[model samples]
Target: MLARQLEQFSCIRQARVQLAPQSWQSGAVIVLEPARPEAMPDAAALDRMLDTLALIPDAPDKRHVLVFDTEGRRLYPDHETDETARREQEVALERQALRVLRPLLDGNGRAEVLVSLDEAEKGRTTGRRTISVLLEENAVPETVRPHLESLLGQACALEEGRGDALRICFLPARRNAAALRGLALTFAVLALAGMAAFF
Candidate 1:
């Protein structure tokens, strides 16, 4: 819907709109494939358009720095270095979210347990945190989700938001043990390193 609206504008030859969900409500990305019309909106005009869209939702935003293009040209909240900084911020947010989940995990299973984060929550962790757990075993233990959920249930009360603390979905492993171990190690290195010495 928004993509079509953007194309109708004289400046945009083609507007590809991908609405960014989870982090900021109104967050979106617009890619302009320079129109042949020879009168497309300039970098400055496009920046303003992005800002207007960012505020379109009724909710207050978390001061998003939206990218107008991949050239590291335009950004929101006016001043910033480049897109690399934004990438680093994303890494930081992921780290924080993982930290929030670390305590509930047993971190001792031989199974290649894959802790997953929703792509939307990858940008920001807010409200009730949701995570997926995939056990790289022929049969995932019945205790996995229940144990984790039980831990989370004790971590906070419903009034304190434990009811939505974390949602763990599971899938049985299909790979050979060795491959699963290697994948689990790689994921652990990226997601759980420094999460705890116990891990």
Candidate 2:
């Protein structure tokens, strides 16, 4: 089943998906590139869609990403009244989405949100806007480390060159075995010396 699901996802273009299970409910972010500026989805509509998705039995228990072909069509309704209103609504939806996914993110998983305006938008031609949260392995919520690692790999391919990759570096565990061995040897030598002195 997992293999089939992966095969189904193999054909998606310029799409990124992330999963975090340790966060409040489990979180995810999905971004699609080369999006047309005119087709964004409405914030309220997105919120409702996510809420409905959350209720699904197998709906990414934590978090996941769903990308659209364009920033405008992906996020806002076509009939939106004003640019300012549309922008505000987009921001609100992104914030709520992040909040919903926060609990799902673990120390191993990373959560990121990205937006790319139309190619003709001045100053945004070569740049993309992104927000992310990364947690190191075994830091707090250790159980989600493996899933986060896999998700990070997928995210890297999805958002390649868009920005610096988010990572959670693991700290090496401390080892006292050598010190204990030295201490034991010193105690043994001292005992031998004391026995010799008594002879």
Candidate 3:
């Protein structure tokens, strides 16, 4: 099944799929190798692989069907292990989520909202991996908060984390979540890439 998907990418020279389940992980897995000795799946190649995996029945779980490079380095599931990589991937997810979810959140832009991403396995009969979207409190005006939350609940395919929605959290913070965590006692805006990219 995966081999056919790999063949579509001209950049891949070799591909391998393994079911090496760890105590922390359960079910199937995908371990990829580079096309050339020095090459790895770029963004386009990655989307090709993940998109195929998405078509499989009962396959919204990204944790099991993950992407890794030739060196056995995680590409898709890179968040928990690498801090810098985590920020990049997590922020990327957050930024994109905000871009899609922002317009839906009315009376926002009073202050910047910092989003954090995490993953978990949920379900009673058949468990599945779910993306956890955590939003700092005050993301929207107090009046709009409930609506924003309800709208996002409808966005995800399943209700794993919300009372029914995928795992969405409203982080309670004393100050701006980004600045508070980025540099304590420092009032600075650590704009990633550009604020425009998110807005």
Pick the lDDT winner.
Answer: 3
Question: How many backbone clashes does every candidate have?
Answer: 1, 27, 2
Model 3 score (lDDT): 0.51
Model 1: lDDT equals 0.45
Tens-place lDDT digits, model 2, residues 69-155: 424234423234433243334344445434544676543444444322222235543333233433333343666655754553453
lDDT of 2: 0.42
- Stretches off by above 4 angstroms in model 1 are 36-40, 47-67, 70-78, 81-199
Ranking by TM-score: 1, 3, 2
TM-score of every model versus the real structure: 0.33, 0.25, 0.33
Q: In model 2, which regions exceed 4 Å deviation? A: 1-15, 32-35, 51-56, 60-199
Better of 2 and 3 by TM-score: 3
What tens digits encode model 1's per-residue C-alpha lDDT throughout 139-169?
3345655465554444332124322434454
lDDT of 1 at 172: 48
Model 1, backbone clash pairs (residues 3+ apart or across chains), number: 1
Task: Please write out the lDDT profile of model 3 over residues 1-199, one tens digit for every residue.
Answer: 5655665677776666544223224434455666676577655557656777666664444444556665546676544553234334533443454665677543443223233333433544323323455555655567766565455544433355433324556666456577667685332353553565788
Residue 103 shift from truth in candidate 3, angstroms: 60
